[model samples]
Target: MSSVTTPRYADVAVGDALPSLDLPPVTRAMLAVYCGASGDHNPVHVDLDFARASGLDDVIAHGMLVMAWTGRVLTGWVPQSAIVSFDTRFLAVTRIGDAITARGEVIEKFVDGERRCVRVAVSAVDQHGETKTSGSAIVALA
Candidate 1:
């Protein structure tokens, strides 16, 4: 199989934008599968009645699930081995049926030890343009 080629450090610049990833709408089945696969079966994410009882309008998507999509955006732009660190914060709940889009932009470039690295600002937004997750990632360059 052919391996993917990512941009070199010398070719990348601060303020460059990473490719965005648009995911399908959040669905109950997706939540259920993620819950099982990730071992994060929180009632708030998969049980509608439990969510309503907890004062939520309906069951919400798992925060990590959304974060994973953001990670996908990063990996899609750069090789997974180039990633040094990644982190995210949940800004808002993701409801079922909401479409999520993951985006990222290079914010800075620096050297850490012998590695050429870039810091990227990343986020995931809902169909309504509300940010549901925000984060940053550090990636080493070839």
Candidate 2:
């Protein structure tokens, strides 16, 4: 019998780390643009009165926007055919003027039967060291 070899997500060794991302800065104007682009007009993201009424002191960045930057880092490491899954958690609100960076570390790499795969621990943080989001990805290499 012959085996067809495919690229795997976790092919990287345990110590391998993906190239990180220094995302563009977040600004209030950017938030307005995002709100327009995404169509998530809950007011909490752009309206201060609504945000304060909802218990926050000020408008905050959309969690999904903050989380999605991890994609930039992950896609840089894995081929389009290799990714299997992706997700994240919101840890803290990112504010206008917050400088965010994305990073990932390979936690495990193993063969899923004949398919190679990788698992990464990922996070986004501000310059102040406040973690804005964290997540993981399980990729199946092509």
Candidate 3:
């Protein structure tokens, strides 16, 4: 965990090693629920045989799911209404049963006209320390 002072939102250069999220381990059932709720039923994320046949060694977790988990971390530091933008890049695959974590840090901050904005670096890593998703976020603070 890191500091959550949020001085960046005040147009000050402040950043810290943001707390990491101990997300529940990935599983087929979890993938299915996300698929059902999000309408992202790519077989490669749910069917092991289909995934292997398609060149993947096994079924993988949805990139967006991991991103969502990463974003959730910021909600505690900054109010949920303060999140203005979130961007992410999928670096590697996350497998079912793997424990994953997300970490973030404030990178830069400036006023976007009248808005107090902060740039945050966010990443999700699997048990192997393999980065599954990485990106930045711009948040508007009250």
lDDT of model 3, residue 21: 90
List clashing residue pairs in candidate 1: none
Which candidate has the top score in lDDT?
A: 1
Error of 2 at 48 (Å): 1.7
lDDT of each: 0.93, 0.81, 0.83
> Candidate 3: where is the Cα deviation over 4 Å?
1-8, 11-13
Ordering by lDDT: 1, 3, 2
RMSD of each: 1.2, 5.3, 3.7
lDDT of 2 by residue, 2-21 (tens): 23244344345776778889
Looking at model 2, report the run of 10 residues with the lowest lDDT sum. Answer: 1-10
lDDT of 3 by residue, 1-142 (tens): 5445444444445576666799889989999999999999889988889998999888998989999899877876776667888899999888888888998888987789989888889999888888889999888765
Higher lDDT: candidate 2 or 3? 3
Q: Relative to the unseen true structure, what is the C-alpha lDDT of residue 33 in candidate 2, on a scale of 0 to 100?
A: 82
Model 3 TM-score on a 0 to 1 scale: 0.86
Candidate 3, residue 135: how far the Cα is off, in Å: 0.4
